[model samples]
Every structure is written in structure tokens, then in C-alpha cells.
Target: MFYFFFAVAALITGYFVYGKIVESSFGVDTCRATPACRLADGVDYVKMNPKTIYMVQLLNIAGLGPIFGPILGALYGPAALVWIVLGSIFAGAVHDYFSGMMSVRYDGKSIPDAVGHNLGKFAKQFMNVFSVILLLLVGVVFILGPAKLLAVKIGFNLDKNMAVVVWTGIIFAYYFLATILPVDKIIGRLYPLFTACLLIMAFGLSTMLIVDGYTFFPNGVGLANVHPKGLPIWPLMFITIACGAISGFHATQSPMMARCIPDEKCGRPIFYGAMIGEGIIALVWATLGMTFYQTPEALQATLASGGPAAVVDQVATTLMGPIGGFLAIIGVIILPISSGDTAFRAARLIIADFSKVEQKSIAKRLLIAIPLFVIGFIITKTDFNIIWRYFGFANQTLATIVLWASAMYLVRHGKAHWIASVPATFMTAVCATYLCVAPEFPLHMSADYGYPIGIAVAAACFVWFMLAARNTPVEVDAVDSPGVIG
Candidate 1:
């Protein structure tokens, strides 16, 4: 029953959200020859074949978030998987693909820049402030979660501080390689190999579990033991879905990839297809979580050993022995590295956009990397699950705002009123109201600061949108601007 709804929801969302929103936004010639559309020659800017671009985008965007978010969602049983699948197709994929397309049309501008250009100066500045905060939280939380997970799996005796040091080193290595090495070589040679390994590990684990006669369905599947003081199932489902669906991180990744796509027509396949792939990854993880544990006690024990990563490792080992466990480590490593590379690149772009620093300079890149690593290192000691939840709320709120901005752009440029406004407005309202009303629900973590922050951001955006509508003149110049790919 749950899987039925899950498939239905994913298919519907793919058609409506991914098909319409992203495709319409970045269709052929939509980003041709504008100032925002300039393509640089080298790793970050070199144009690539559409198919290659699609593959690169998929590998980059499909990271640990999808796996962990869906696994967490499975805590509420298969009912949670339905929402995860639906939300990923509709909200998550659309957010990532359109956000990338929108950035491309704005000369490689980010979501914050788009807000400022389409809305007003205040909107841009407000978004920047919120974005930096959100990024800090996201960077720290994401880094820590995977690091801790790895530590537990390997039986590393390092404390949180030491674990952070090791994690930072790994991140730094990826960033260094990405920045210094040619992207084509990396993507052409390395990315495929990495992705192939990921697929092998993923399928190998699944097959092993099945062959071992592991129960395909969780036993005692009920939401009875969900944490009452924590955020409830429905709201947490929304938040978790946001990680898979519409992460703020995508705002950074999409534009970077857009600049590298060989032609304007490639945007749809590269951006939209990548997002769909990410949704599939999330679904896989959700399935794993469901099949692996049947009771709250089992889930807790797995968590105590580590977290979702450990649970995944345990399951793989249970099915395939030590070889599977080793493969799991490699698979886990790929996730953080993929996300970290994107994170570093995104942070560099954001910094370059806002500051006087030149992205071309090695010093400038290092300057940005150092602070980011430090922040990530410091926050490694904090509880990752809590931070991840907060990130979902804040990140999703940003996605809602981006969706509105995209709709406005389509209406103004393409004059697709019904197509543009209806879905966009619906998503905005659903996401906004969900965040705002969520705190009132009887759920664990309801009283957390993240929920209130999300509410405040949503409320402020509502007011900002209203005022901007009344006072500011809409600028459609960006619609024709060319974007830089990197």
C-alpha cells in the first residue's frame, strides 16, 4: 500500500514538477547568448555534451542527504516513504532543477541574487543574511553526520574533535583536487568510476539482504514509538523531504553546472534529470531503512552504534559479510566527498559574488575554504540529527521562496500565467503553511529554535513579497542574461 502511493506520487511529481517547472524554465535557447550565459573554458566553465552534463550533475547532487533523510522518514513506517517519494519528485527535484535554470538565466547569479534582481534590494540582502546562516548550519551538520557515521563504522577511537580533524582533511583533499585538477578529467575519468562503485555497492547490499532472506517488510510497522517531544511524523516528513527535494545546496550546484553545459538545451537534461536521479537515490535508502529494522529498539541500537550510516553498514555486512562492510565504507566516503566538493565550489561562488575576491585566484579559494572548514570542524561536536532537522526547515523555506521567484520569472518572460503561477503558488503555500503550522503540532522537537526560525523566515518572505509586489518594479532583464557555468 505504501509503495503504491510512493510510486504514484513520484510519477505524478516527475510529470508536473520536474517536467513542467524545470523544463519550461530552461528549455532550448532560453539561456542563449545573454551576459549571464557566458561559458568559460576550463574545468568550471568548459561546455560539455548534454549527456555528460547529466551524468555529472547526478553524481554531484545525489549525496548522503537523500539516504539519511529518507531513512529518518522511515521511522514513521512506510507511510513516511510515500511522502518522501512524492515530495522529492514535486518539491525536491523541481527546486533543484529550476533553481539551477534560474541561476543560469541570471548570469550565474544565485538565489539571493535572483531575489534581489526580481524582487528588491532588501530581498536580496535578507536572503544573503539568511543564506549564510543556513549554509553555516548546513555545512556543519552535514560534515559531522557523515564523519561520525564513518567513525562508528570503522571503530575509530577518535573523539568528536579528532573526528572533525580527520573529516576536514578528507574534505580539503577533495576540494584541492577539484580546484586544481581539470574538471573534464575528473568528470570523464574519475566521476564515472566513482559512480560505478556507488551503484555496485548499492545493488550489492540490496541483493545480499534479499538473498539472506532478510524480511523485506519491517515487522511491527507502526508509529507508536515516535518521539512525542520531537517533531511529529507529518512535519518531520516535510523537513526530511526538503533535503531530498529542495536543498539550498542545489542553488549553488545548479548554476555551477549550468555554466558547464555544452549548450542551452542541455539544461533540462542535466538539471532536471539529475534531480530525478537524486529522488531515486532517496527512495532506495528509504527502502533499505524499512527492511533493516522492525522495532524502535532495533533502530535505537543501530543509532547507538552510530546512526543511519552504521545501520546501513550493519545491514550490508549482515547480508554480504566483511566485503560488504568495506564496500559500505567506500560508498559512504563517496557521499560526503561529492557533497563537500559541491559545497566548497558553492561557497567559493557565493563568496566571490558577495566579496571583492576573485574566484580565479588560488588564495581566494583557500581563503573561503579555511573558514568553512573551521566552522564545519567546530560544529562537528554538536548533535548532527538536531542540526539536520533545523537545516531541512530553513533550507526548504528557501526552496519555497525560489519556487515563487521562478514562477514570477516565467510569468514575466514566457507569459505562461496558468502554468507558472498555479503550481508555484501551490508549492509556496503548502511549504510555508507547513513550516508555520508545524510548531503547533504535537510532535517532538516542536519547541526547537529551528522551527521558529523557519516560521519567521516564511512570514517575513510573505510580507516581503507583498510589499515588493506593491512598491517595486519587476525586472525581467535577467531572463535574457547568459549564465557562467562552473
Candidate 2:
């Protein structure tokens, strides 16, 4: 419990202290006109209230990633808490802030464009495809995830499979509408209310934990691998706990809010602060997972029998009572649904930006969105577990790329590049090691081979960055040039 409180406090402090350093390095220019004001298309680039943008950004990047990820992450024991606090402060929030602010500097273009400016055209084009596929996966996963949970909730003598199908259609319908609608109409308006429910659920669970004196760590905060399967803590825990710590998916979502930010001044709170807020949500869920079962082994048993959704249902109802539990379940459902809608929306924007289709027209928006949803619907039929496993790897890989891109951005501007470069190097190792050793991959090598290779790969990448940094020309007027940086 003390550790949990300290972790939360550290996250809050990190937002003010480390977040400020990031904001300063990025050089948030309040006097400069934001994409929302400068490129007010009324569709995507509409000016929004800072507070609303903050809430929407939180919901956009969060989804069930923070909650579900941390629950699974708790299998690794108290090390999850250490990762959440440190990762959110140094890696995740910084990655998110730069993703959003870089978009603001680039006239609210999608992430591919932002990467293109710094990492060159090939990186931009690569990210364009990589980001779209990841967004589609997120949309489909979120759709199926909430649909199944809601199916259980609305049991009416309906076959569970049929109920899931019914809810899937309903969620996809909502995603379609949210994808095409004006920014302020659906996401901007509805997210704040949904975000409120999410916060209420998290805080309510947190309050009960404190009042009841639940023991978060039965032993001292030891970094032992308590995973029932003996999964090593190095890469698996890091990948499993992506959003709660640092998810690259958040980078894709950040630009969506970047277009809506009314001023540069709100960048830190909305982007960096949202990541910290998610870290808190993740901490609450991780605590519940660790304590509610009384042991990690028991938690693993429950997980095997019912999966993460079932765990969420059982925990909420058990701890919060019937009424509060129902609301808490609704909050859990809302988590993914809110993010699902935006995932599609972000996909549409990415397609439009790359395709050069002006999204101001409703016809053009649908042209981009219909094909995307069709693809998303097709993906829903695949094994959810397979997709999720791949999503975690792909998600972190994207984060690694974004971190490198951000590093390049910083290096070009002559600001401290280490902030982004260090995390990029670390995640590069994590992703590489996972690919080599994870059973899900084709190689499936032993950790003995994977560990050394991962470190070597990361070192090579760092060397490449050092060499490239010296050669790449610095943008003298990065703040003024929309053709390069704003």
C-alpha cells in the first residue's frame, strides 16, 4: 500500500517536473497559432477547450490497454509497479508529448508525416502502413473485447456467440459514425462523460483498496518473477504492460488530439499528463489484481479460467457490490469502446493524409472509412489471443520507432536528444528480444541466444543514430517552417 501511494505520488511529481523538462525541450510556443486555429477545417482541426482535449486525449490513448495490460502484468509481481512509475515518467509520457507536439508543429498531419520530416521519406511511408495496420488491430480488438463483455451483461436467453455477434455490429456501427463525424460532434463531446465514468471506477476501486487495507505486496517490493508460467520479467512484462507504462499506440492517438489542441501551452498537461493519468489507472488495476486474489498463483488461476475480461467482472462485482459493480463494468466497457471509435477515426485520418484526400467533405471521409471498417471487420474473425500478442509486439515496435523519430526531431533542433534516444534504445532491445524468444514468433529461440542478440541490435541502432546525428543538417527555423517543422 505504501509502495502504491509512493508510485502514484511519483507519477504526479514526474508530470510537473519531468513533464516540464520535455515541454521545455520541445519548446511549446503559446504565441504560435496551433493547427486547430491555423487549419480550422471544422472537421478534424477544430479548436477545443484544453480541459476537454485533456480528457479526450486520456480516453483516446487509454482504452482497455492500461487496465487489461496491468492486470496481466501483475502476474510478474511488484516489479510491475516499478515499471509503471519509471516507464510513465521517463518513457511513455515523453513519447506521447513529442508525438502530439510534433504533429502540432507539422500542421496536425498524421504521425507518418511527422516521422517523414525527421526520419526521411522511407520512414514516413513505413510508418504509414505500420500505423494503419496497428490502428485497425486496435479498432477490431476493442470492438470484440467490449462486445463480448456487453454480451455477457445483456444476457437474454441469447446464445453467447450470437450475443457477441449482435454487440459487435452495434459497436462497429458506432465506430463508423465516430470515424466520419466532426471532431467536436462525437469524440470531443462524448469522451469527457465516458472519461468521468472511467475515473470514477478507478478511484472507487482505489478508495476501497485503501479503506480495506488490501496488501499490495505480501512481501517487500521484490523484483521476483512470480509469473505462473515462469515467463521472464525482462521483455514479456514490459510488452504486456504497454499502455500503463508506455504504449506506441498512444503515439498514433496523440496526433488526433494534436489537431484539436487550441494552444501549444496545453500540450504538456494533455499529452504527458494523460499518460501519467493512465499510469495511475494501471496502478489501481495492478494493485487489485495482486491483492484481490491474495496470491499471484490464484490470480493466474482465475485468469486461465476466464481471461482478463472475466477477471475484471469478478473483481468489480466482488469489491464494488451490485450497483457499483454494474457501473464499474460499464466503465470497463467504455474504456475500449471510446478508444475503438478513435482508432478507426485515426485510421481514416492516416489514410486521408497519405492518400491526399481532403477530409472536409463527408463523401471523402466515408470513402476512407468504409474500406477501413471492412478491413477491421475481417480482422475480428481471427483468433483474439493471436492478434493481441502480435499487437503488443507491434505496439512497442512502433513506440521504438517513434522514440527514434522523436530523438531525430530533438537532435535536429539542437535540444537534448538523450530523453528520447535512451528510451528508444531500451525499447529497441525489449522488442528485439521478444521477437527472438517469444513462443508466438517463428524463431522461438532460447533466451540465451535472444538476450545477447537484442542488446547487440540495440547497440548497433544507437551507433547508427550517433553517426546520423552528426551528418543531418539542423533546421535553423524549425519553429517557423510548416514545410519542415512549425
Candidate 3:
């Protein structure tokens, strides 16, 4: 109980202290015209209330990451809690703040464009493909979970597979409209309510757990490897907990809100604060996963038998009763739907930016979005485990690249680059290590070889960054202005 509350307090405190320092480093200029003000095309660039944007951005970057990922991460015991607190504050939030603010600074360019601006054209081109694929994966991943859940909850009485198909079609239709429509039309109007439900479910369950004395850390938190499979804590836990800690996927989502933020000052709360909020949710869920089950072995058994969704249902029903279970289901269903729509939307915008196509025309939007939806639908037929495994790796790899790019942005703009650079180095090692050891990767190496190789790769990259930083000239402008991506 004390540990859980302390972790929550740490995240909140991180937002006020470290979040403020990050905002200061970027030098937020309240007077500067944001993309929404300077480039209001009434389509993607329409400005809305900052509060609404905060909720929308929260749902956008969140999806099933904080909930599902942390539940899976809990197999590693309290070590997951430590990662959630430190990773969210130091890496995830910082990555998000820079990704969003950099887009705002660059006239609302996509993340690939922002990455390319700092990293190089090659990087820009690579990220263009990388981000689109990641978004599509997100769109597809979010769809399957919700579709399956809705099918079961509704009990259509049709063939179970058929019910899933019907729900998938319904979700796809919504994604189409949400992608092609203006930001305020589908996403902005609906997300706040959904976000409220999501928050309430998280906090409500947390409160009930506290009342039940279910979340007390009787073992007083240790670093023991508690996974039933005995998975190493180093990279596996990091990957499993990507969304709650740090995710490259958030970088893709940030640019969408970047185009809507009315002032530079909103970046901290909307981006960094949202991440901190996610961390708290993750902490609650991780704590629940740890304490709700009798033992790590039992949690693993429950997971293997029915998955996280089953665990969530049992917990909600047990603690909060029927109404709470219904609300929990609805909130969990909304999690991916809210994020899935924007994933497709972000993909459409990324493709438009890459192809130099204007988005003011509905036909033009369809030209990109149709193929994307078609591709996403086809991907749903593949193995979910394979897609999720690759998504986890790709997600972290993207975060690693974005952090390096963000570090480069600070290096050229002449702020405190270490804030980003340090995290960049750490994620680089994590991704490198995962690549070497993960079964999904072709290398199929053991942890013994992967660890040293990963550290060496990180060290090499750090040296490269240091050399580049020394040679790169500093700009150090006191004020930011709209700039061309080239």
C-alpha cells in the first residue's frame, strides 16, 4: 500500500519537477503561434480546448499499453513497479514532450519528418515507413482486443468467429469516418467522455482494492526474478512494459495533437503530464496484478488460462460488483477504440506528408486511408502473438530512434541535451539487447551474448553522438518560429 501510493506520488512529483525542467529546457514561448493558430486548415489543424486535447492525447497514446503491458510485466514482480516509476518519468514523458513540442515547432509535421529534420533524410525516409507500419500494427492490435471483447459481452448468439467479424466491421467503419473526418468531429467530441470512464475505472478499482486491503506490499518490494518462465528482468520486463514506461508508438501519436495545441505552454501537461498519468495507471494495474493474485505463480497460471482480459474481468467483478464490471468492460473496450481511430488517422497524415499530398480533399484522404484499412484488416487474420511480439520490438526500436533524434534536436538547438541523450543511450541498449535475445528476432542468441553486445552497441552509439555533438554548431535561439522541414 505504501509503495503503491509512493509510486503514484513519485509520478505526480515527476510531472511538476522533471516535467517543468524539460519544459524549461525546450523554452516554451507562450507568445509563439502554434500550428493550430498559424496553419488552421479546419481539417487536421483545428484548435480545440487544451483540456479536451489533453484527454484526446491521453487516449491517443494510451491504447492497451498501460493496462495490458503492465499486467504482463507483473510476472516479474515489484521490479515492474520500479521500471514504471523511473521509466515513465525519465524516459517516456520526456520522449513524449519532445516529440509533441518538436512537431509544434516544425509547423505540425509528422514524427518521421521531425526525426528526419534532426537525424537526416535517410532517417526521415526510414521512419516514414517504420511509423506507418507501427501505426497500422497499433490499429490492428487495438481492433482485435475490442472486437473479441465486444463479441463476448454482447453474446450475439451467432458463431463466435462471426460475432468477432461483425464487430470488426463495425469498428472498421468507425475508423474510416474518424480518419477522414475533422479532428473535432469524432475524436475530440467523444474522447473526453471515454477518457473519464477510463480514469474512473482505473481509480475506482484502485480505491476498491485499497479498501479491501488487496494492494499491500507485504514483501516490501524486492528485485527478485519472479517470472514463472524465468524470463530475464533486464530487457523482457522493459519490452513488456513499454507503453507504461516508454513507447516509440507515442511519438507517432503526438504529432496529431501537436497540430491542435494552441500554445507552446500546453505541451508539458498535454504530452509529459499525460505520460505521467499513464504511469500512475500502470502503477495501479501492476500493483493490482502483484497483490490481487496469491503469488507470482498463480498470476502466471491465470494469465496462461485466460489472458489479461480474463484477469481484469475477475478482479473488477470480485471487487466492484456487476456495475463495476460492466463499466470496467466498457472502459477497457474504449481504450483501444479511442486509440485505434487515431492510429489510422496518424497513418493517413504520415502517408500524405510523405507523398506531398494535400489533405483538404476528402477523396485524397480516402486514397490513402482505404489501402491502410484494407491492409490492417488483412493483418488481423495473422497470428496475434506474432504481431504483438513484433509490435513490442518495433515499438521500442522506434522509441530509441526518436529519443536519439530528440537528443539531436537539443544538441543543435543548444539546450541541455543530456536530459534526452541519457535516456536515448539506455533505450538503445535495451532495444539492442532485446534484438539479440528475443525469439522473435532472427539472431536467436542467448542472454549471455546479448547483454554484452547490447552494452557495446550502446557505448558505440554514445561515442558517435558525442562526436556529432562536438562538431555540430549550436543555434541557441531564445524564441522558436515556424520552420520548414528541409
Q: Best candidate per lDDT, number?
A: 2
- Taking all chains together, each candidate's TM-score versus the true structure is 0.80, 0.98, 0.97
For residues 1-486, could you state the per-residue lDDT of candidate 3 as single tens digits?
778899999999999999999999888889889999999999999999999999999899888888889999998989999999999999999999999998998889999888887877888899999999999999999998888878877857888789989999999999999999999998999998898789767989889887987646554588798888888998889999989999999999999999999899999999999999889888988888888886888888888887887787777778789888778878888988998999999999999999999999999999999999999999999977788889999999999999998888887887779999999999999999999998877997987899999999999999998888787677765123222222
Once superposed on the true structure, which residue ranges of model 2 sit more than 4 Å away at CA? 479-486
- Position 175, candidate 3: lDDT: 93
RMSD of every prediction: 5.2, 1.8, 2.0
| Model 1, span 1-486: residue lDDT tens | 355335646655675555665575545574366332365645456666667666667767666777777777666666665565556665666667677767766766666777665555676677777776666665565556556666655535778667666866675566656644446766545666677667766667666656767675555444353532344654456666555555666666677676666566666567766776676666666667767676645666776776777777776667667876677657766765666566656665676677757555666667776776666567656667667666777776676666666655554454443333343454555455465555433442433554565456556655554444444333455564322111
Off by over 4 Å in 3: 476-486
Better of 2 and 3 by TM-score: 2
* Model 2 lDDT tens row, 1-486: 888899999999999999999999998778989888988989999999999999999899888889889999999999999999999999999999999999999989888888888887788889999999999999988998999899999956799999999999999999999999998998888988997689778999888777777776775578888888888998899999999999989989999999988889999999999999999999999988888878888989898987899999999888889888889999999989989999899999998999899999999998999899888989999999998998999999999999998998898888879999999999999999999999989999998999999999999999999888887667875643322321
Query: Number of clashes in every candidate structure?
Result: 18, 1, 0
Worst 10 residues of 1 by lDDT: 477-486
Candidate that would win on TM-score: 2
Instruction: Pick out the ten consecutive residues of candidate 3 with the lowest summed lDDT.
Output: 477-486
